[model samples]
Target chain A: MNWKTVLRLVSVDVKSGRLIRGQRLRRYRERRLFQYLLYGGACVLGIVIGLGAGTLYTAVPDPDLRTLFYEGARLLFLSFPIMVLIYSLIFTMMSQIQRMGVRSSIQLPYWLPITWEEHTLASTLAHLIGVPLASIILFGSAIATVSIYLEAVPLAILTIFALVASAFLASTTTEIFRVLQARLIGAVYKSSGRAAVWVRFLGSLLFLIAFYVAWFALTSGGGSIALIEMVASAQQAGWFVPYVWLGMALASFMNGLLAQTIIFSLASLLFILVLFYVAVKLNAKFGLYEPPAITVSRGAYVPKVGFLGRLGFSSLEAAVIRKDFKAFTRRRELMYVFIMPLVFILMPLMQYSGIYGTPVTPGSSRFLSAWILLAPGAIMAVMLGTIIIGEEGGSVWLFFSSPITARSLVKCKYAFVIIFSCIVTLVCGAIGILIARPSPDIAVVLLIESMLLIFALGAVSLGTGIKGADFTEVPRPRMVRPLTVLVYGLLCLVLALAIFSPLLLHAVAMEYIPLPVSLPKLDLYVAISISAVIALVVTFVFYKIALKNAEEFLIKAEI
Target chain B: MILGLIKPDSGSVNVVCTKAEDDPVAVKRQVGYVPESPRLYDFLTGLEYLDFVGDIYGLDASEKKARIEEYLEAMELEGREGDMISSYSQGMKQKITLISAFLHKPKLLLLDEPLSSLDPRSARIVKDLLRKLTAQGITTIMSTHVLEIAQAMCDRIAIMYEGRLLALGNMKELRQKARLPGSDLEDIFLKLTGTEDVREVVEALLK
Candidate 1:
């Protein structure tokens, strides 16, 4: 090995590490390493538990382990699309870092008499090294467990082939998204026409919808077929259905059917290799263009409608809000905040209506109502709070050093939360009407439930806003594990219940409860009123604590 | 008629203002500013960027723009900004940070770098901008540096680092307290401070 080449590679890793470490140290201080390890451990634990549960549930007499192996392989195949989405998010974040200058370290070798191709290759290797190792480990565990369960050489070989194909698929998908984003932005800048920009934006939205629809059909239809086969043949088609031909070819080879195995393997390899090559070439060509410079010329001084002005905010608070709004709207990534909430609203409707054809019943309606009211709060709590601090980037000192009090900054953030929450609540109410078409009494229940849900979400969001660390520079990986997701979901559920319990009690008293005993509607009203009063008190108390804690947090922050 | 950031709607003012109508963006092509506080994106590298000033001045294309290497070399920033500006030393960032105000060879320069993080070498380079630009009839309005350096470098210096002007004039004319003759600029500065005992104390501290 050439020592100089090796040292150059080491320097690249050191520079990337130093850049990441400095960011983590400043934003998270000593807690970052612990948090990363905690998240990784959670993921591993979840996988182990899930695998154990699957094993316990197996009921086949003289159960062929091949069935379990096939099931595990299927789960891995299903995880591919999610992995692709995560890879896209990572690539977008990495591009942002490169734009900022973290990638500039690669230029050092350029000045040091190193060839461009070698430097690029080394940099690519270093880049991959920086990506979290969690996914690879997970993939490895999945393959190992599946292989052991089946003790079938064919299934094991096919699983390996699928894993490699998935990686190529993920990389290609990310590149496609990047290219589309770049082209769309370039067109917008070149035209300087709002209509053109809107058209492009809508086109991308439609494309995503079509892609998801196609994906849903394939996965669900394939899953149903596998389920039928499991019932009929006492064989789990798990990963086998997705990699059916590969499995067949592998089985044939194991049974001394070499001609079939060779044909299948060669075709699959050729297809994946061609795609990988094309994606690499496209990425190289697209990455060369510089980001467009947007120039905003000052126009006539138009005193716009002061929304915050009506909220009794000081001039400083209004100014900060305006600044944040301008910054948020300018960046395409931040626009996800507006779009994502609508997605949450649509998810239940899509899953139920698309596959099962089960129209929303009264029971499902209650669940939907709860989701509508609380989903925005949970999203804003994590996504908004985390991003608000992170997006300030290194210019956080501007807020700190300004005459604007920290209280005002925090208040403005809360104001945004409230405004967004109200919008979400209104949308939820509308959806409830469409889904339930309930009596006037039901409408009132929804109104009260929505209010309680908003307050509860507010309290939780305030807590997260104060406690969450900035992860602005940390490229978002698939960091949150299933357990963490489950925990968050359970927390939201508990908050929603606490908020809506009064309404539930009111329904029971009004003889709206199906079982036990009939009671007066007035008694139900009284119960709901008391619950509302308690929720209000709790919200106020949390708001005060949030303000105090947030101030302390900001002061202690490393900005 | 172009909008100006500092324009007063109903007040009379005599300060020269660059309006967008007069190609305000173009005016910034030649202007450089050292803001009261430097704020840069933490993720961007030093040499990988030409700074926001460069972009605002519209040097987006190749050939016309200053090479990142040239600025790094001139600012003596070698390996610093190549990492994120967030990782830079305060003084290092301040030195190499050429605002859009100066990116286009502005005929006028505005600087707030007086007694903060600027080192001697960086300080000297900033001082040279005024001399070089003014030779081409470019005007400079700098918040004063150390009184001695200001005295030596300025043709018409205004001492206003404290947010209010203390004195404004040429060095020779403002040197009334240098009675012993051939007293350097530092002695003139001491005289301007106006108490013999306090001056002696300050002089002793400086020595």
Candidate 2:
């Protein structure tokens, strides 16, 4: 391996996102100081944390309590390696799945004079460098410093070594999985033809959902401690599994089983080497694989007006709407717009589902029902509306050159956002009703509030999107200007509050306010009517703003 | 200015006899523009894209069907039209863009590097089609870097330099203006642009 070349590749991978932001720099050397400063900062923070932990351990006063503390710390130290390995594996896998949703990740520089082993090793290291390495440094420093106070310096040194080895093992395993996924996905695309589109979309969606579910399960209330305990037990129970061998070795070392410790340590090192070799081999085999052309329609072409036309849209308006729908469904990057709403729904649903041991109280259930019924659709509206025009990216010139009026463009985009958001709301609302079983009146109120938010926020986002659409698609597409998106989000928040405040006030008054004087109850209809009126006014005002922006957008095609 | 894609600094613009400010949509309806480096929606199949273009131009379903089919067959993209444009070759994408421009049969064609990425036969077909359409009173304003193409295909050529018209005329008038009586368009163009002495630059590079 050319160590220099591998190091260069690793540096490129590490600083790729930074490079996009620091394009004004003529060379990497110009940013070298900043990189060093960041490294120094992390080291300082880690050392500070280490000193603090050591001091905390030394301060345990009572003899019995100190003994308990020492035992708990020893147990934690024994399991730390396995815990790091699990975290590294989960994070690397999540990053890989996220890359699959984008058009391109940090691509391997194939034209460079680098061996497959070097490239694979560099990638493995780079993927681990971000969160995994930083965390290891911090924890390792803490462990070392605390060990001095506990008078177990040699064991702490061994545990730190095991931790590093476990992290490397996890990274190498992730590298193999990444290569295999590329080959498998390429094979599926080549053979599946039209079904490949949905297959890829649904597959990415599944992985994304799994990542979120795993994350929620692991991080929620005492989940991390529970996970470590489970892993510790599994390490003892499943001694044959190679993954937990590092932790087992440390545990054995603490228990004075020198033979077992030496054997497991040696085996773990060998396993890591084997994993690295397998990852390199897989990369060599499938690193250059390209996905085949996806034929969406193979039959003779038929030019009939689609369902959008039947919904009373003009041919021009219907065409734009249909194209936007196809864009969202077919484009990998745009698929996130669909996936995000599902994720929003899934998060709250998981809490209420009793799957993660989260107790669903009456208040929690009410919040879940309201959130599941309202938030996804409203969020989808804001997201979709803000991105609809900018999602055109380069092809927006088609709208500019075509005989499309600004009114038609706004109507088409607004209609699409409303339609798609409504679909999401209905699906999510159905799920919410089935799960939460809210009363009919509450459900109706939730649905109405959702509709109002969607309409008003959709227009608000549309106006903002048109005003600040950024069509640059290098590195990755930034659909809207950052400032514009911020404004859009803020505007949506204000408008959503305005539209929901009446209902919100009624609920708060009923729930919290004492009624010694017998205050008249504000009827649900009255609140909803007020909200609907506010939404209608906001929609009318923002629709005009959106129309004006569209006119300027069509004429100002320089972007 | 013509398509209202960008506004003029200090002057009015009209296209197909419609003032852009007065009725930009009307002007757009009459004009079919193929931009330089045309950015197509890669997610859509070529057929779907063409259908979209047809619908935008208010073409009836039957007309859209006939025209898209004819264009696909003529461009030798019949079987591949169902594939997403993302998977298409550059030449194939150019053909699709050309087809979309022609689908509506607009009164005027504004083409920028119209023959770029085209196979020779496809280029010949486009050349012949433009000639026929021109004869039928459909004006075509094509921009090209290939001087030979400009010399052969154009009745009147306008040479632009730094956003200013340096020369406007037929071959005879261009030759007369450049004072290169027997020289071709390339020679006249190089001379006009003051970049005719490229041998010195080439020698400097070699050295």
The model with the greatest lDDT is 2
lDDT of 1: 0.52
DockQ, per model, reads: 0.06, 0.73
Span of ten consecutive residues with least summed lDDT in model 2 chain B: B1-10
- Candidate 2: TM-score of chain A is 0.88
State residue A288's C-alpha deviation in candidate 1, in Å: 2.9
> With candidate 1 superimposed using the best TM-score fit, by how many Å does residue A243's alpha carbon deviate from the native?
11
Can you give the lDDT of residue A205 in candidate 2? 73
lDDT agreement of model 2 with the native: 0.84
In model 1, the runs with Cα more than 4 Å from the true position are: A1-142, A145-149, A176-180, A192-257, A271-273, A295-307, A354-360, A377-390, A467-471, A474-496, A508-522, A553-557, B1-37, B40-207
Best by TM-score: 2
The CAPRI quality class of candidate 1 comes to: incorrect
Full-model lDDT for every candidate: 0.52, 0.84
* Poorest lDDT segment (10 consecutive residues) of candidate 1 chain A: A473-482
lDDT by residue (tens digit), candidate 1, A1-559: 3547755774655354444433444454445564367447645764685466446544445556645655654554434323433443354334442333222222444366654334443443344333323454455455545455445445545545544444444444444445445656655754653243344346445544544444444345344444434332321243243333344444445557688767756665665456445544544555444444332322222223357768786544665556566444443345555555666666666655645466766667666665655565446544554345456654554343232344665687766666666776677667756764556666676666566656655665555545554434433211123343455446656766776677676767755556487655656567677768867876787677667766665444344
